[model samples]
Target chain A: MSGATSRATTARDAHRTAHVVGRVLGVGVSLGVLVIVVGLVLMLLRHPGYTTGQVPLHALIGRHARFPVGIEGLVRALRHGSAAGVVLLGVVVILASPIVGAIVAAGGFLAARDLRIGVIALVVVLILLVATVAL
Target chain B: MPITPLLFILVLVLVAAVAGLLGSLVGLGGGVIVVPVLTLVFHVDIRLAVGASLVTVIATSATGASRLLRRDLVHLRLALFLAVATTLGAITGALVSRHVPTRVLFVLFAAVLGYSAVAMLRRRPEAAPRAGHSDAVANALGLNASAPVGEGGQVVHFEVRRSILGLVAMYGAGVVSALLGIGSGALNVPTMDVLMGVPLKVASATSSFMIGLTAAASAAIYLSRGQIDPLIAAPIAIGVLGGATLGARLLTSVNAVVVQRLFIVVLAVVAIEMLQKGFA
Candidate 1:
């Protein structure tokens, strides 16, 4: 192969490799978040205030498959619903945290030599996460 | 006997695993598959099921966006524009959806499916790079001129008008996504590729990239309304993200034509089922 062609091939190969490394790192982050979520759910279950409902998650979902009564009905149920929403939000953030972390980590990893891209990706993700939490 | 919580979790995991794998493989990201299964098999409330499905859409987008962005398949500027339009459309559509009968939404979905099927049949199997896109057009559209597709590869140029149309379609996609809880891939792919002249692969990847933003737009509304169940969304999102990663990996070896064809057929069948439910 010609030198230029060979160099181009190597560059593409490197790009692909870096891309895969970043994604694999991301998956690792997602798994870590999943673990943390499970732990928190377990802890929540052990607490005195919370108890497992009579129906499994699947059955509850199945039985309630109709459209919600409306905003007014939900408003009436707000006291209980809001409480659930707060806990639910926590579970979502915890479960989803690792995926975001991994994605940011992968960007940083790929940009290891390049400070700008690495810093920008990581900083942006950190900001988004913090913002999501604040909201 | 009632299924245990553990068993329900297992079922969710199984669905996610399958959806993730199939979604990545066929480019639908399995939200379409998961929505029906959750509703039909699990008997989850359509509203909550749709809500959960939207979360899966986010997972699919997140998993696909990072890699696709690096590959230059995701058109960031275009996506940003579409996101704005689609978000506006989503708010309008969601409000309208709430007041309209559920059957109307079902009828609209059937029409969308019919439109998408015809659009799919008309799409080119092999994406052809469009001719006549100049450097100025590329710069104007804010498309990345730095990385042109491979050496001597024609710089993929796009028309602003068609992209706007694609965005309009995406607005419709946002509404459909909010209503049905499926990733708007069925709508997005055709709009971008057939309508806007993006390559098939880029169209699919870009659609995936767009889903997160679109879902985020509506998820807030659902969250406020107390429609989001953390216990449900948590497991579903985790499963989808993991499954999509595996699916993207599997896409490397799969026969995409066959898979996509089968997917179109499955979509057709589902659309018919939905029509029955609507008209009946």
Candidate 2:
């Protein structure tokens, strides 16, 4: 009876964790995609000739290419109200979603007192943060 | 064809949607398709292509894993445990990528993929969960999980075996991903399903969940380097998120045999692609 109870409890905790993680993922993606679409529409509206020019794949990737990069650049562009800045914000959100999800999972596991898995989750989160910042 | 920016974006979104759907189905991150299409068809630089592909991988992973988690297909504990190895390996691979010869790495990865394809083909699918099958390491780590296999919410409990081996394989997969600028989901699924005795469905879903973390590690570097062009990445992300969401929904209803067959085909194609890159 104790075994069965413990198993049931574990399953319940897993279910709750899954539920919370799923919501986080869904919301993150939806919000990011919406922002990107809005930015794209704004870009097209602002530059009516954007559709008229040929795709500048080569120019866009050239050494002289100028675009926002990193957090500082992203903030500057947003301040300038540039469409690309809005889109970059969306991309940033999309990129951050999984990391956020991992953090939430770690908290959930720790709260549930699954010390082994919780510690593992925390370790993973640390690796990810270090990789993101350092590498 | 006059490839205007609007037309290019439309085509990319369409192609990325297909890549996202297939990738989510097999947990491959869709980088293979996205990279090729961007570089070959759109004439985008390889660096930019890789950046866009990383975004696609993250998008597909997030959307697909989210749905899979809701269905209890993802083994969250197992994924978290293995991610430590993979993330560290990815960082190491990135650091060593410039020193290694690309051709040799490509050929070696192709061979590994070929062997994986053959091994997966020969292995029989698990019909039902094994009763009383337990592993000390997995039990201690709480890696064993249950999945809803069929109609009427029937759940099948599965055990994880040889978790240490799985972690090592994931580390290798991460290295390959960073070196080749691919998701290495081919390696991940096989490691979990073939080597670690994880059910194929669970393996694929968990792999999907895991790949995002691996891709994010590289994506941050790419973003800082200005490799990710907003115009290119935005559409790919949007399209992949939509397609992956659909693919995750389909996976729950699809037959395991069908998914396996499709994965084998994907592995074979990836191997051929790597071989071409290797010998070119």
Candidate 3:
């Protein structure tokens, strides 16, 4: 292929990758935010006093607060139908979006025949996964 | 004024919205505003504030990048390449954060931010170079790309230079981000714009794109450690996502110089705040 043609192909591939990755991020974030908003509304309905009572913000965020932590705790909260669990699930989804996006980008690069960047993206994904589990 | 828990969350959401707007425009994670307000105004614990801010940063980055990506502003290859360095650095920082004397690190970071602000002020905007003008490393990585500017469809094609240096700097930025519980966009932007020769707007957008992955690394650690409070993170995530979406829409049309000035102001403010924290 001519230089110009090759450049155009590269640009097209990059554009396609961006489009797919952008869709992933947008969809993930929108869904996560929607879930979080629903969870917040549920929390309000479950505890109407939250609107009138003098419960300080610290009651929820303070050291002694009893909220779920980690994936196992989040799953337990969800199983028990906890409103906070729904919110935590949303947070987890939000955090997971970028990781999903990176994975998609890696696949896109590999499909485009860009081995170097594809491998680099894969490495990044591995590092992120390791950070999640090991750190 | 005794605010109820609901009212307090409402107020916090509003504050986070503003932080998200500015942070998205400047490629930051909005922690500079969220952290201080959550700790000082809301009087939340610092750990929770940082945790919330970290989550907010991810929201900002995801929302901002989603929009910027469609506009062809984010350099995906460069972002992914840099993420490798930054993600590893973030884990290292998270591990070392417990052993490090945070006060000294805060002071050192403050100095770095202060210097970056001045450096940004002194540097003039760079014109996009012609295609095929990049170094061997950049060429091999295909880091050169064109970005559409304004509504006129005027595209600015720029070359990436000294990418190896930019990668090293990004590693340091990730460490700083993890150690300070802040988005390291203040460092990422300059490193890309100055060292790598990317245009300011593209640099900012790409930094925003990369910060999400970088923050996610440490945010996971925070999540597992029970530092992330759902009540706090939920509101922040929602507000920041909304604000970031709006900011990303505004970024492509706004003047680059205006964006740079806003970032400089943010940098100066964060530097001063870090200095105070170091002393306190």
Query: Which candidate leads in DockQ?
Result: 3
The C-alpha RMSD of each candidate to the native structure, in angstroms, is: 7.8, 3.8, 3.6
lDDT of 3 by residue, A54-115 (tens): 56555777778889998889999999999999999999998998999999999988988888
Task: For candidate 2, write residues B29-131 as lDDT tens digits.
Answer: 6676676567546657656776777777777778778888887788888888889888877777766755667567667657766876786677665455434
User: What TM-score would every model get versus the actual structure?
Assistant: 0.70, 0.84, 0.87
Q: What stretches of model 1 exceed 4 Å from their correct place?
A: A1-36, A39-87, A90-135, B113-123, B132-141, B144-163
* Cα RMSD, model 2: 3.8
For residues A51-98, what per-residue lDDT tens digits would candidate 2 score against the true structure? 876435445445456779977789999999998899889998888888
Interface RMSD for each of the candidates: 8.7, 3.5, 3.3
lDDT, residue B171, model 1: 82
Candidate 2 positional error at B54, Å: 1.3
**Candidate of highest TM-score:** 3
Q: On a 0 to 1 TM-score scale, where does candidate 3 land against the true structure?
A: 0.87
Candidate 1 or 3, higher TM-score? 3
Q: List the residue pairs that clash in candidate 1.
A: A61-B44, A62-B43, A65-B44, A65-B45, B23-B29, B23-B30
DockQ per candidate, 2 decimals: 0.12, 0.53, 0.58
lDDT of candidate 1 over B135-245, digit per residue (tens): 333334333222244336545444433555665788888777777666677777777666666666666766776676566556556655545555556567667777777
